[model samples]
Target: MASLHAFANPARFLKIARPLTGWLFWTGAALIAFGCWAGLTQTPPDYLQGDSVRILYIHVPTAWLGMGGWSGIALSSIAYLVWRHPLANVAARAIAVPGAMFAALCLMTGSIWGRPTWGTWWQWDGRLTSMLLLFFVYLGYIGLARADREQGGDGRIPALFGVAGSVLLPIIRYSVVWWNTLHQGESIGLASSTIDGSMLWPLGFTLAGFSLFFAAVVLMRMRDMLARARNEARLRRMARA
Candidate 1:
């Protein structure tokens, strides 16, 4: 709690992140490049889905992080509300846009994979519908955060939405099991993965790569927002003089 509170100071946060961001960015890049190569070139085609299953290497990881990022936002929002930490609010806001991007990517990739396997672009299955809802929730968070700078900056609006969204997350996750649907139930991490070892390592690496990328982007965005806040403060002081 103390450590989190300390980072709430924008200046203090930047001092640490400035040096750390470079390493995180480059390392994430390398991991992503290596993972993409391994996923696309090294992994053999799936026995059942063939080449299309390759999409899982990226799509699955993105979906995982989409949910993970929302969790981050929710946690940060809690901190922001309780601690009134400006940096926490910035961090939460920074995540919303990128999280939405990941959600959209997941949906598109899933659709492409489905077209090859499910014989249609989309189905109103438990997983598919829940995923769609998740994407819209991300968009809602991003849009609400950006809707009015004055109101949004107050931290009330986004904070409420963030809290509400967090509550909805479990519903999304369990929707597949709760409803009888076309979407398969927990086959991999969610349940016992029938995926072969040949494909699993590369898929695992891709998941790590996507997580690293998300961390890097979130840090970069937070850093930029802190700088903007600092510059605005400086200008305001100058104007008062």
Candidate 2:
């Protein structure tokens, strides 16, 4: 909490983030490269779904990230609202687009994987229905934030909506437990040997890589947002002059 308070200052964060971006960027790239190779080429075919299961390597990670990204936004929104953290607001704004994109990827890849496996392009199952709601929430958050930016005021309105939208995550997660679904329940968990060890490692790496990818993009976007803010301020000053 103390560290978050310290870093919530934009000037302090800029000084630190600029130096780390190079290393973080390369690390994210390397992880994605290794994860892609491991997922596509090294991992053995599934006995049940065969090569089709390969899509899980991408679909699962993206789905996880989509949810994870929302969690970040919600957390940041709380920090911004409570502590008036400028950096938190910036992060919330930056993450919205990428989160939505990842959600779309999850849906699209899942759709592709479903056709062959389930013989249908879409399903109204609990998980699928909740996931669709999640995607719309992402869209709504983005729209609200962008609209706030256009309106020339504090971005808190959209941030509040973002925090509220995160409520859907728990519902999406428990939907399978509450009702029947075409989508399978939890994949990687203790006491469950559903996925073999060999395949699990690559999937794990892919998840890590996707997470780092999200972090990198959010950081970059945050920097861009800051730069735009600075530029807009300068432009307004000149206009006043």
Which lDDT values do the candidates have, in the order given?
0.82, 0.86
lDDT value, residue 103 of candidate 1: 83
Distance from true location, Cα of 104 in model 2, Å? 0.6
Q: Model 2 clash pairs?
A: none
Give the per-residue lDDT digits (tens) of candidate 1, residues 1-241: 7876677666687888888877877787788788888989998998889898888888888888888888989998888788787777888999988898898898899899989898999988877887788888888888888774556367767887887888667876777778887766665865557788788778777788778778888999988887787798899999999
Candidate 2 has its poorest 10 consecutive residues by lDDT at: 185-194
Clashes of each: 0, 0
Q: What are the RMSD figures for all models against the true structure?
A: 1.7, 1.5
Candidate 1: global Cα-lDDT? 0.82
Total clashing pairs in model 1: 0
Candidate 1: minimum summed lDDT over ten consecutive residues — where? 148-157
